[model samples]
Target chain A: MRLGPALGWFSRNYNYEVETQAPLQKHSVGSQQRTPIMYASLFEQKVVPVKHSTKFRDESVMKSKRISKFLWVGALGSVVVVSGLAEKVYPGKVAPSSPAQTTNSASTTGTSGYNVTSSTLAPPPASATAPSGLSATSGSSSSGSAAAAAPTAGS
Target chain B: MRQVLFRQDTLGTSCFLTSRVEGVDFERRFIAACETFSERLFELDQVASRFRQDSEVMRLSAENTGEPVSVSELLFDLVEAAMRAATITGGYLDPTVGNSMVGLGYSKDFELVRRDSADGMHFRVVLPSGYRTLVLDRVTRSISVPPGTILDLGATAKAFVADRICAELEHLYSLTCLVNLGGDISCSYVGQEVPWMVNLTSDGSLDPTSDGMLFGIAGGGLATSSVRSRNWLAGGTPHHHIIDPTSGESAVVDFESITVLAGSALDANIASCGAMAMGHRGIIWLRGTGLPAVVKRTNRTQMDGIARPWNGSELEFIGDWPEELVQLSGGVAC
Candidate 1:
């Protein structure tokens, strides 16, 4: 009965944590193919906990390392997000580095709220190198040609 | 060499001009053909536009005196075409659904039509009939509809324009060609081995020009009826332009978009709209027609009964598409 106060103090002072981690993954080659600016979500999925621990370190030292790591991740994430936005906002500026494989057929499925901003008559940004994503029919039986002449169709 | 041109022409829809001709001036000739094509579409709009109060069709709806009045060459042709469409579609593609359109808050031009009424006017009930009351006096070159009927030829007007102009352009320019008004595509480049390939996409309009599905068509026409856009909220309920004559309300089709390829743009347009108006039964009707088509629903893509890996290339048509377009396999007799 006398030990109850001591137990309560220990419980309040210590942190018990269980973390379920999704496996760290690299962006699929298909995902990376959409160049000029790739979506931030691509990297968000790849986020790996660079470091984790229960062992205590010098308070000042731990804080400094954490700050540096936080800054690094934040800066990289920001760059990815900003670049993706830039590529999308001004898609016409860049050549379609690759015929990006759309998440869904925009024409058949009505453009949802988030994608409305990217839907435009402006052609896909021009890319100097052949952008990746066009291999939709690569493994499949179909041969998807990049230079296939589509009839000049209108919206 | 194959060449393509895109233009925003008459009928308030984007027009695609596809040319495949060898030896010379394909680009110049294609542009000129589009110019002529656009002017003709404008003229047809003036004569057939129900949105224009002064147009012939609108005038008829506004002043249905019921007296057999002399009709113009265009009006008579349009009326005949409308009746034919209604007949082929078994009233599924009713031209007299104009009142239903107005009742659902699309009374005037689509752009001019208010999405929501200030008075909170809306529809939640079945509407009355209009097509059954129309009377055409072929002998006298006149037509009449019941007093209350609103004759909107929209169900088939644009298709007729596409069909007419496509044929005109091919013969006039002496080149293989295609005329795409939004999704209503009329093509006639049979001699060229390579068919006109169309991939329907939607940016926001009824038919977006981005990604959907690719259709390789030769000699015939294709049309798409998608319920994604040109819709609004009425009484907090969603309403669209495609109205079912039987229900007297906007159709409740299972598919998000239906694209049909028929012997003519008119037939393709009728089948596409009729499929939308018929709801799920539209697919059955299309199957009966045996025309090549692609229907994209919210979850699945389907086609007519046939096999895959058609015509050499590795491409596989997603649906049950046939190897080639059938003339009419036990289809709804048009």
Candidate 2:
């Protein structure tokens, strides 16, 4: 039992017939109103004889070719759409551009450091007095009195 | 000049506003300013709170969908400011530590977490995905994050809000104001002769006699980050809210607290948090930034003893920190 010839015979007879007839039958085109033969015959030998043999084989092959073309196109389109969606959904994972590079390259200012060159320490406010029980003291430059001090701590 | 002070509690912390207004309609303007501050704070919490299931940040975390999510301008600005903080600190103060916070037994609000016992609590080391993974589009006011990346803007949100509110008050009411959210402070300058006096403490205490130092700033922001605050115990181990993104654990540092002064509250907060995360390297980083800072470290020997005096602590001043003016007995003054 040679595997090559057996597989070829199986494909040409069973697979080819199923592939060719399924689309034409689904389209509801009768065998009599067959389109003209467009391409050469794939298999020169015939196992079974039927009416309009040329038309049947030609129409079937043409229809099968049309369907195959459509399938190839549809498959290509699906691949494209799926790829696009994946890119959109998983942008960071898909196109992993370095964050460091992006941050460094960003033209935006005030993103890299404190905006001020140096911190400022001013004298106490004038004309503001501390509430009772809290002592109000001014800094070295005693130009103004002290206001109620705001407390700052870790939270 | 007449000055008014307002205080309220929101966003799980206290907020203070100090304004100096000189006008005949001072009463009405003061009331209106207070109302505006409340509205802005509520808006910030709705958009940025991590504990609230309905908040935009929580929803974004729950969805875990890597798509651009349109958010309010406030939230967008918050995220953008957080990312800027990450950039400035070289990823030391990261916003993408939400999962890390939960894993460290801070899964709920700080107050609630403090109430619950940590006897049988278990945790895993959930490292942050890094802030760089976040994609923000300014044009659309949308943000995108990687799936499973939880962002906690706790480091910068309050400071950002303080800065925003201070700016808003100044812009809208023409008032010289200072806004303090929790420990983050921002003030507006109008060439006034008096500077805003701020008490620096390791713990967030408003008590004037609490062993702390005092400093005066003409304008800008001040923020303090400490390991002593927002700390809890999990499975018999101590944990803090500040998560080191590199290790996915609470930062272990020698200093008990670090306070930074910058042009804005957001900047100050970022520097302080980044310094905390950097540990010993923080001093060098802080010096390099040329911002005024005061770092406090508890004396180990003093802690060993039963009684710990306030003077037992060591304070290091850096980058043009002013000299002590009025010193409280046994406490450092700046």
List chain A TM-scores, every candidate, in order: 0.20, 0.21
- Write the residue-wise lDDT of candidate 2 on B47-146 in tens digits: 8888778888888888968999887777777787788778878888788999899888887767678766444577788989899899988768788988
List interface RMSDs for the candidates, in order. 22.5, 34.2
* DockQ of every candidate structure: 0.02, 0.06
Which residue window of length 10 is worst by lDDT in model 2 chain B?
Answer: B325-334
Which pairs of residues collide in candidate 2? Answer: A125-B194
> What's the TM-score, to 2 decimals, of chain B in model 1?
0.83
Q: What's the residue-level lDDT of B40 in candidate 2? A: 78
lDDT of 2: 0.61
DockQ of 2: 0.06
By TM-score, the best candidate is 2
